[model samples]
Target chain A: MSRRTALAGAVAITALLLQVTVIDRLHLPAGRPDLALVCVVAFALVGGPTYGAVLGFGVGFLADIMPPADHTIGLLALAYAVVGYLAGLVEDVEERSVVTTVLMVGLASAVAVVVFAMIGALLGNAHISLSAVAHSLAATVIYDVVLAPFVVPLVSGAVRHAEPAG
Target chain B: MRDSRRARLVLALLLLTAFTLITLDFRSGGGGPFRTVGNTVFGPIERAVTAVTRPIGSFFASLGHLNSYKSDNAKLRAQNRKLLEELRTSDANRAHLLSLERLDHLAGQAQFRIVAARVVAIGNALDFEWTATIDAGSNDGVRRNQTVINGDGLVGKTLAVGPTTSTIRLGADPEFTAGARLAGTQESGFVDGGGHNPMTFTMLNTRAPLNVGDRLVTAGDTDNHDRPFVPEVPIGRITRVLPTPGQLYRKAVVAPFVDFTSIDIVGVVVAAPRTVPRDSLLPPSPSPTPTPGPGGTGGTGGTGQQSPPPSPGTTSGRRSTSPSPSRTP
Candidate 1:
């Protein structure tokens, strides 16, 4: 991998690591802010879904590992891969603005929640309630959107010279 | 169009994947083979994340250390001030423990073994269910039905065990109901979990006078074994007791002694195993807990008591009858 791409990959993993281990612990409103979602959306909006999807898998794989309990290793990997794929869709358009990135974060956060729930369901973790899933989705969308305006510009502006892998 | 089709196909597959995982996990799918695969794929990534985030972890750890240090300093001064009080309480606890240990010695029970586990995963995705995953599993001798304890009190038991990790349903999981006895009065009841926070402890029979602040402990009797299932494990102090004077039984709410909200370390007790030598004819198998853990009893019966709750929607244990002057057998 090119040095810039490799650095971006490391940064993405760091962001996700901070997420499950620390950011997840923040838990305002009994819900956690999806920092990885914001990061993934930012990258994907600038890089396109294909790049986003691939990055998503990388980040998700790391996230799955850092949980308080990481029994099912790749559960997050699958979930994140999907989220990255969705974020990749944002890259089709030419003009990438901060607003667009924030919007992508909100949307991607929703998708992440849904995918996470769906995967948990498949794994037979019986206690998940439909309502909590919905609320988490709503909460993440709002959190990501709120964070997007600040994070997107910082990431996109800083990474302008750093091109994403296709 | 082709790109869109490919993208749509990927999205569709992801949705399918999410759906499949949700269904399988909810059902608990009997065997946790798939989870092992999930762990394998994600293990490297998790390691990388940890290595990459060590600095961040160190920062947080230092902050936590400072807070705890301050709390400890205050506690030590209080301890000095209450030296006399400490002696009194210490004498009382010593007396209590002396009496209890006598009983244990008489019974020839093994000394308690505590194994520390790392917090690997927290919270079940897709639902409001409150649970966590620990790195210790069948390989760690963590078995199905093993009792898990934290600093505060009993958290829950092991449900699923993989080679390297296991799944534990916190006491607050909606489907969990445990057989518990209020410490002070010996009034036994069934503790049930409803939501994510405080859980409810209900006496099957009516007329047990329960109050806020009443402490709860394990009943220590298993129906099948007639042996003390698990040793004296604390549950929590009663936070609220529902008043139902006219009803057959009364229910009380308890704030768990172990703070499920901020759990970092846990110990799983390898309780009385299931593989109790069904017959002498067969060769001895390793473990008996439904899901085997690393360092688990490995089918060794009579090692320790398990505080494991019922699987899914099932719970076992009959309610104690209305307060009798004497203990019911």
Candidate 2:
């Protein structure tokens, strides 16, 4: 595996652990931030569509099978993969202003939540409700956006550092 | 252009694989080999991470609640004084009840064989599922569907058991439901979790009288094996009685005794008592006067003063009335 891929994998796992053990326990109002999702977006923006989608799938799969996960396996994988691919489509994302990048992260986070909720509804998940979906979407977007300034730059920078020089 | 096509292909392949896995896992009701492997692999890693990060987690949690600490401290001090007074008075009542129990061997509190466990991990907040992983598992005599409780009251029931850890669906989960009975009247009902909101209790008999401040406890299984919940584990108190005209059942909103958000220490009942506990587990009525009747008899007069209804939005830290001190057994 490439050094960049290994770094991404390590980062994703760390984010997953912290997300479940610490962030989830915070019991923040509305909902907790999706740290793994933000990490995926960061990796995607740095590596482009193909790399982003693959990393998203891997991270999502880990989340699905993570302990205490009662939801269907691969649900997160699907959402993250799609979001990663979409995030990579943003041209010159790294070159964009911090404000623009933050906006993109917010947009991607919102899309991921909507896609997950849509699939959950299709699967006849009994817990799905319009209000709940809206609440989660708002919370995810706000938290991810607030978190983007700190996480996105650090993750993307690490990925860039891990890549071989031209 | 080639890279774009390759990306599309990879995305499609991954999406297909995800969909396939989802179908298989869903059809199998989450008992697929993949899930087992996941439990075997990730369970240990999660346990370790939780142990290492618990201090840090609590630090942040305390920081988050820093604003409430001062007010909470004062409120707790006042509550402590009141509880101390109640304890002194309840001592005589407890002794009296013990004598009565010795007189009538059949009427006494159930003794549970419990395995104490610490909560290691919590379910993802993004997902609507409310579950927590406890450190105790089948290796520690924990089993699937066993009742989980804390000093406060009913926590939840074990869902999936690993060798050293188990997953419990919290009572606040939207899908969670348990049989419940009113503490005094013994009017049986079922409690339904409302996710982030308070639980709802539905009485089986439509004409049964319901009142605010009335407490509810686990009804246990009809077979008395206590598969999921043991009888008389204090569930919650009625906050509001919904007026359901023409409905076959009556519904009431319940504020559970155990706060689902910040549960840490828990006990899993490995073996239930030989006899049903009935209302023995409920916290003593808040009234200062101890009822003269036997523990089995309904004592409505002491608890008649209605506890102010908890606001609909507040879901945690509302344990204004102390639970009974005799719940340790």
In terms of DockQ, the best-performing candidate is 2
Best by lDDT: 2
lDDT of 1 at B5: 68
* Model 1 lDDT tens row, B199-220: 8888765644566666677665
Q: Write the per-residue lDDT of candidate 1 for residues A44-147, one digit (tens) a residue.
A: 66666666666776676555443334224456667677777877775767676667667767777777777666656655544446765767777667867888
Model 1 TM-score?
0.61
Candidate 1 lDDT for residue A20:
49
DockQ for model 1 equals 0.24
As for candidate 2, its interface RMSD to one decimal place is: 2.3
Give the TM-score, chain B only, in order for the candidates.
0.56, 0.70
User: Can you give the lDDT of residue A30 in candidate 1?
Assistant: 53
Interface RMSD of each: 5.1, 2.3
